[model samples]
Target: MGVKVTGTVAAGWETVRAEFEAVVAAQPHSPEAQLAVRHHGRTVVDLWAGEDTDGETLSGVFSITKGAAHLVVALLVQDGVLEPDRPVVSYWPEFTGHGKERLTVRDLLAHRSGLINTPEGFTIEELADDAFIAARLASAEPYWEPGTAYGYHAFVIGALTGEVVRRATGRSIREIYEERVRAPYGLDLYMGLPSEAQERWKPVLEALPTPAQLEIQAAAGPMPELLPVAFNWHTDPPMDLVAYANHPLVKAQGPASAGGVGTAAGIAGMYAAAIGEVDGRPALLKPETVAEFAKLHTPGLDRVVSEPDHFGLGFERQPAVGPEAFGHCGAAGANGFADPVTGIAYGYTRRRFGFPGGPAPENLPLTAAVLKVARASS
Candidate 1:
């Protein structure tokens, strides 16, 4: 292969390395991908295969940003800095204006707040600033009545939750992230990119679907029509996900919802730190905190994603077949989650957008491969 697979896997995980190579080899164009898995607090797999990319290249990890942002919430919850069941207006008084005063912090976390989008769709400039997003959304009535339904907040959940963090702690989530999680652990994931790390950023490539691809996607189950509304696509001009992420300003501001930039190792290491000891540090979340955060919060239909799955306090209970994993998947095929049972913290990144969006189809085999190795090792 022209683009070589580089990085190390622990001795017992050679098959994972082989699978990584096969994934890269099967791609028609240059596939830029990074995969990392930390097993039992040790990074047993670190590999990257693609052109113009090495292990350090940071990719825009769309909604996976939610996992990173919410981990901060989990930390504060562990510390009793905020209460999940408290009415959000208790933390930020302005939350009262839109009939949202009665909604609990847990309601927002479970995607039941109903403030999915606004009448005036956000420009990329507006989405770049979490405060502006929170402000605009603060007074907008929920698309559905609060607590009646759960939907993926999609573009604005983090901003919604981050605003609560700001009110409770008097610091933006980004700042708290720097002091508590990112800086302490030296994570390459950046909610806000500093000057020094700009050179390592890789702009994501948008993939246009072919007719065959479109047909296959339609066959898989029609893409949710309401997704546009959740993403603020009803206005005259709509958001282009690739353009939103690639814009220089967007990366700089690092909006809490979707502006996160990271490497696979960075994402993998983050989940590992949250649930398992890393380096010399203990896990950030206590066992009780983990249990509370991972418990099924959305058990009904997810109106935004149009799937019936469980959402747990902002983290996602991925699917039925995989190991009981919890974390967020992003728009451009980035998937990162912690399998608490297997002690596997996994992250995968791709610079190209996939047709069906969210996590790529390849993730199934990749996850299976990782879980198989992890279980065997355990």
Candidate 2:
């Protein structure tokens, strides 16, 4: 039977729905997923597909959590509580040495710190706790000279940045996010998934390779060095990502890097709140703050993830999508961002893992469709 996609699209956006259905049909495995878009602080697109999926269904949004984490950082910078040009060590004293004392907060947020992974890889147990992750990283050395080059910090950027947040304020990123962003804005995203909200979560399904795909993967041979480090590669016993989030410990601690659980509406709504007013509140960041954080911090070859495009501050900038579009794509084909030009906040999430991960290939058409509609509506 074909997958049933259910949801509502605002008037004049029926094409976006067709495009979303096209996206569902394009997936060979008929992945369970959710998508949402908010334009000018109003939700215009909300949809989902596959069994056990609904508008409120939550999933592990992989790295899209970075967008939430960094949004807090941007707020701090905006409030004068944190200075971008100052040394990271100023806030956290132990993050110095190994030629890293000179590294500024701007450089760290821009991914130029060269502190990608812990000297010793973090066990899933250790990885779940932001405090432990940050403490270990405090003494870790950088793979390259700080500020000279940029690479995706991947698994540990949140802890690195989160520790700075904790030092500057006696609160965790989750706490600040809840009080300032999630709670007030009524977003469905969670840095820490609460016990009461567990029922709403949709378990993420792994993308098992077909026989032919497995053959191709085996033939490809050795995985990239940084790739394994970033993902915390382990095969003596394969660790299940879904189980990790389902575990009571991880949900309680909510590791800032990738432990976020959220729905498409939550992610999109958060971004909408960032760029525009919603529910009678003001936009979170001023135009100057947005422009500053969105500035291209890394514009060339990325040494870590080996991607050509890196980020500005904590956001990955996609000029092709929009000059003002800034967000991050997660490991499980989830993506969220806000574009100032079109006043669009977008999010797409899937429980089933997508091939060659990182934003998945589906965002191109979905975003293009949304952009077309947004431009027309304006």
Candidate 3:
């Protein structure tokens, strides 16, 4: 039997429901998925499928946390409390030395700092603690010239940026998010998952790849040397990303890079709040700030991921969604973004680790359906 999808779609968005149903049915396992979208600051689509899953269920959203972290940075920059062009060392003096004297806050946000991870990998415990991650990276040397290239700082971009936020505001990103963003907006998204909220949390399931998929991955040859290091898997046993995310301590600490937990509604709500009025409050970011942050800073091949990935200030350039769309994709088939031109905010989450990782293929078709309907309705 097929998984039953449940939710409401606005009158003009029937096609979105059809596409989502098709996508969910095509998954190898029950996707346990939720998808939500906002157009011009109003919720238009909210859907969920699979057992124990619904619009409110929370799951680890991996790198989507970067969006939340960088939103804080954007707010600070907008407020003139932090300057992007200023040297990072100016804010955190200990970051000097090792050819990093020239690195700027903008470089860190663009993933151009080249301080991916240490030669020795981190314990799962250490990965959860942003302060420890920041301290360790403070004096490290960049693998490449600081601003010359871009690479995924898979595990530490938040720590690096968060440390700066701390130095400038005397508050952690978590605290600031709660005060200025999440709490005020009543978003289910969380930087730190409280113990009381455990009941709403749904653990992520591992990927179930077919033999053909395994063969394809094997044909791609051995994992790149820096790949494991970038992923914090250089150690002998190699850190299990699934286990790391599932660990209670990691969830509790909620390291800003990859520890965010939220439902699709919450994630989409954040983007809606950023670019449009939400519940009578004005948008969090001004139009100029959004343009500045969403403009592509790294549009060529990424050194670590070894792909033609594009990055803006702290968000990935989702040209597939729209030229101006900006957001981050999670490792477990989650993606969230906002397109200022279209005035669309989108979020998708699944409790299962997807076969090929990163953003799932389903997003392409799903988003295309949404854009088509949105344009027609508009």
Candidate 4:
């Protein structure tokens, strides 16, 4: 039997529903997933599939938590509480030496710090606590000269930037996000999934790769030296990302780097709130601030991932969405972002890891369909 996709689409967006259904049908396995879109601060599409899943069901959103983490940073910068140009050591004293005294806050935000991980990797428990990660990273040496190369700080950027937030303010990034953003907007997304909300959360399913995909993986052979380090593979048990997110500690702490859980509406609502008026409130970010945070700061080959990637102030530029779009995608297929050009906020989550990871390929056509309707409606 086919999994039933159930949800509603606003008038003039029926094509989106059709497209979403087609996408689900094309999946190799049933994807227990949810998708949401908000245009001009109003929800236009909300859909989900698979057993026991709905528009409000929650799942691990992995690295999309970075978007929430950086949103708080952008707010502090907008308020003049944090200066992007200042050296990171200016804010966190211990984050100095080892030739890193000159690394600016912008450098950290742009993934140019070269401080991917400590010589010894973090245990799952240690990785769940940003404070623990930050403390260790304080004295850790950069794999490359600070600000000289770019690599995804994979598991530590949140702790790195979160530490700066703590020093500049007297609070954690989670606290700031809870008070200034999530609470006021009542967004379904959470930096820390509370105990009471546990019932709504679901575990992510592992990717069931096809025979051809297995052949491709077998051909690739041995992992690169940097890939394992970037992903903290030195731990005794290493780190199983799927298991890590499902762990209770991660749900409770919701480490800003990866431990976020929420519905598609929750994340899409966040982007909507950031870029447009929502529920009688003004946009969370000013147009100029959004532009600055979304603007590309690092371009060209990423040393760790070895791909041509772009990053802004802690935000990943979604070139596939639009020139100025900004957001982050999780190791699972989840993603959330705002496209200023179309005044669209989008979020997608799946309870299964998509093949090959990092922003599921389906997002391309899904986004195109939304844009098509958005332009027609406008």
Candidate 4 per-residue lDDT over residues 1-378, each given as its tens digit: 778889999999899899889998988788898989999999999999887788878888999999999999999999999999999999999987778899999999999988899877888888899999999889888899999889888888999999999999989999999998998988888988987788888888888888887898789887656877988877677788888888888888989999889889999999999999999999999999999999988888788777676788899989887768999999888888999889999999988888767788788888899989887777
Write down the TM-score of every candidate.
Answer: 0.96, 0.95, 0.98, 0.97
* TM-score: the better of candidates 2 and 4: 4
Q: How big is the positional error of residue 242 in model 2, measured in Å on the Cα after superposition?
A: 4.2
The CA-based lDDT of model 2 is what?
A: 0.85
State the RMSD for candidate 3. Answer: 1.1
Residue 261 displacement (Å), model 1? 0.7
Best by TM-score: 3
Candidate numbers sorted by TM-score from highest down: 3, 4, 1, 2
Error of 4 at 202 (Å): 1.1
Worst 10 residues of 2 by lDDT: 233-242
* Clash number for candidate 4: 0
Question: Which residue pairs come into collision in candidate 4?
Answer: none
For model 1, the stretches where C-alpha displacement exceeds 4 angstroms are 1-3, 208-211, 218-222, 320-324
lDDT of 3 by residue, 219-307 (tens): 99986557788998779899888897798887898899999899999999999999999999999999999999999899788887876
Candidate 1 residues 106-190, lDDT tens each? 9999999998888778888888989998998887878888888899888899899999999999998888888888988898888
The stretch of ten residues in a row with the least summed lDDT in candidate 1 is 317-326
Q: Rank the candidates by lDDT, best first.
A: 3, 4, 1, 2
- For residues 208-272, what per-residue lDDT tens digits would candidate 2 score against the true structure? 65677678778988866666666666333545556665566666677888889899999999999
* CA lDDT for candidate 4: 0.89
* C-alpha RMSD values across all candidates: 1.7, 1.8, 1.1, 1.3
